[model samples]
Target: MPRDGSATRERILETAERLVIDNGFAATSVDRVIAESHSSKGSFFHHFASKNDLARALVERYAAADVAHLHAALEHARAATDDPAKRVVAFLSYFENDADAIMSAQSSCLYVSILTERDLVLDGTSGQIEEAVVAWRDGFAELLRAALPGRTPAGVDIDVDALSDHVFVTFEGAFLLCRSTGDSGHMHRQLTVLRHLMEALLGAVAATPPRRRRAGTPSRH
Candidate 1:
């Protein structure tokens, strides 16, 4: 792509992501995006076959960036701690901090807004959206699985996928509640509960191992 085309593409995607987050996918229009992005109609059509095509590209582009941020967060956690469970907690903490920013009136996740429009045009946008969602869910599941060796609470037998689903649901539900109630704090509160639940479910170190006795020393009474 030419330098100008690449820049125009990015601008279009950014504008669409912002508009969709604010007004929802169904409510936003291609003309609005073109106008907001400051690109001509021909340029918009050059990069996107239609609004549906733009939606598809939006999902892929935004999802890639979002997933990359998650990966970086997890990596940073891994660097700061040797414990896998702690790394999982760190990942959630990063999201909590991010949600704090959102509550401060930053934009909510774009994918959340896009997914609500289940009637998206059948221009492959559905698959793109699904792929984006699964990518995010799987990333969390992979981390949770890594931390699941012996951390779950007693009598619990959840697979990684189940745990991932729970975490993902918590996030999506929180977003919905916050948007519906016009309460930004809803997300932070829900995520706090989620973090605590994970600690209970996946950080359950029921008991400590017995300490080793010193050589030639008497055992504890």
Candidate 2:
């Protein structure tokens, strides 16, 4: 049988999630969570070792949801277009929409908030949270590479891996800038520029002929 105390624990977590979302992790206090949950201090501590533990749990929960949505968006983009460049643009568009909705629903951007507090967040158990965030960024880079398999330049040498990293970093930065400025227009402008860059890269790659086989190199197929 489950302990009746489990219900109180859940209430505490739920309240913490809400308070953190609404007031931010730093601003939220144990007193606020307790009042919000209508639970005693003992109940809160019984459920979580400390407020930091609750914050860690809240970040993990948010990260899981964000990753799931990102994967779904990537899948949709892949299914929508065969061209790698087109797929990348589609994925960014999907992400832009998601960001728009989040900005509208919550006055705060969770990822941006965590990133801004990197010094503090990195010092504790939240280090795992930072790792999760980096993984998410790397996931975006991987998706970009998969979408643009023919990224090798012919006449001029270009590093596909570097290019992919640039795209991912730029996109993430654009979101942060948009949120900081409270201007959705900035996101749209930045994405438009990114779309153009994608088209140019694709065109450049398409214009290049396939690398000629070496005199005695065996073909894979």
Candidate 3:
């Protein structure tokens, strides 16, 4: 593709992403994207074979950037601290600190918007969305395991995987609530709460004594 063609394609993608994030994929149309992007139908079609193709491309681009940020944040957190618990807290704080800016810049999550539409467009993106989510879940779980290297609080066995899922759910739910309430601070507050919860959990592990395993008793890992 020529430099101008590439620029036009990027413009269409940006316009489409903005529209889809704001109004959802179902309501966003090819004509609207073409008009809003200031590109012709010919250019739109030349770039994307169909609306589904556009959606897939959007997901591919969004997922790549999203996962990249996730990885970068975790890497930064790891470098900031040698202690597992502090590293985990640092990771959460990384997002919590920027939640306001992130919320101000984006009205809603693109993945959430796409999922809510429940259209075949999700399939168009292959497994990009799922992979991005998995990356988040797995990344958090790894941090959680590192934080709780031994026995959990008292006799309670914390499920790191489930806790990881909670992180994703909380983050996404914050976006939903923020969008619904039009509260710019909602996401930031939610992230702060999540970070506090993680801190408390870590504190609990530190404060509580680990229960000794009884002889002949089965362990519930």
Candidate 4:
């Protein structure tokens, strides 16, 4: 049978992504990926001409996935509620579920790793990260626009753009804290706090935080 080229490429990418996330990209050599993935030099080179090429591909793939998650969360939230405030809360809940899954796997965000090792990756990869972050800002901006009118806190002016950016700020900060503290539940807890704060700001009823998972228990994303 002919070699499954796409499967081989995906396997290499998957292996590289895991290593880059766990260990810094500067420390995860192509040789390490080859050994870990059970791929040969020729196969690895065939799929990725160089480590730089692999880094670019990784950022592209990660950015695409991040945008997809943003859209999916918005879609699901819109479907669940017509009230824009509630929809915004629902959108955040999607990420809370994601935090649980990441906690279970004991993996941090690949983007965070990429950002910390900014000098190692190409400039284009940084652009991809910027684009993903913008998508998130715009996504939240849309929801907040619809939800904020007539609901803004008394005597307070909310900049839609700044408020939208806060969503990303909160999440990325929570991830960093989780990495620093070694507390698996940190991300989910921080997300829950953001959700409640949004509820209060938008005058929506706050949803109860989901039950805490038992230690070592797996979570479904």
Give the clash count for model 3: 0
Which ten-residue region of model 2 has the weakest summed lDDT? Answer: 212-221
Once fitted onto the true fold, the runs of candidate 3 whose alpha carbons sit more than 4 angstroms away are: 1-4, 121-126, 204-221
User: Can you give the lDDT of residue 35 in candidate 2?
Assistant: 92
Residue 77 CA error for candidate 2 (Å)?
1.9
- Measured by TM-score, how close is model 4 to the native structure? 0.88
Write the residue-wise lDDT of candidate 2 on 37-115 in tens digits.
9999988888788776776666666666666665665676678677766677676565544444444444444554454
Residue 164 of model 3, lDDT score: 91
Task: Give the Cα lDDT of each candidate.
Answer: 0.70, 0.61, 0.77, 0.79
Residue 184's lDDT within candidate 2 is 57
Candidate 3 Cα deviation (angstroms), residue 121: 5.8
Candidate 3's residue-wise lDDT over 67-122, tens digit each?
87788668867887788888788877767766766776578878866766555544
Best by lDDT: 4
Query: Which whole-number lDDT from 0 to 100 does residue 152 have in model 1?
Result: 66
lDDT of 1 by residue, 157-201 (tens): 887776676766776688778777888788878877777777776
How many pairs of residues collide in each model? 0, 1, 0, 0
Model 2 steric clash pairs: 84-147
Candidate 2 lDDT score at position 99 = 44
Alpha-carbon RMSD, each predicted model: 11.4, 11.2, 10.5, 3.8
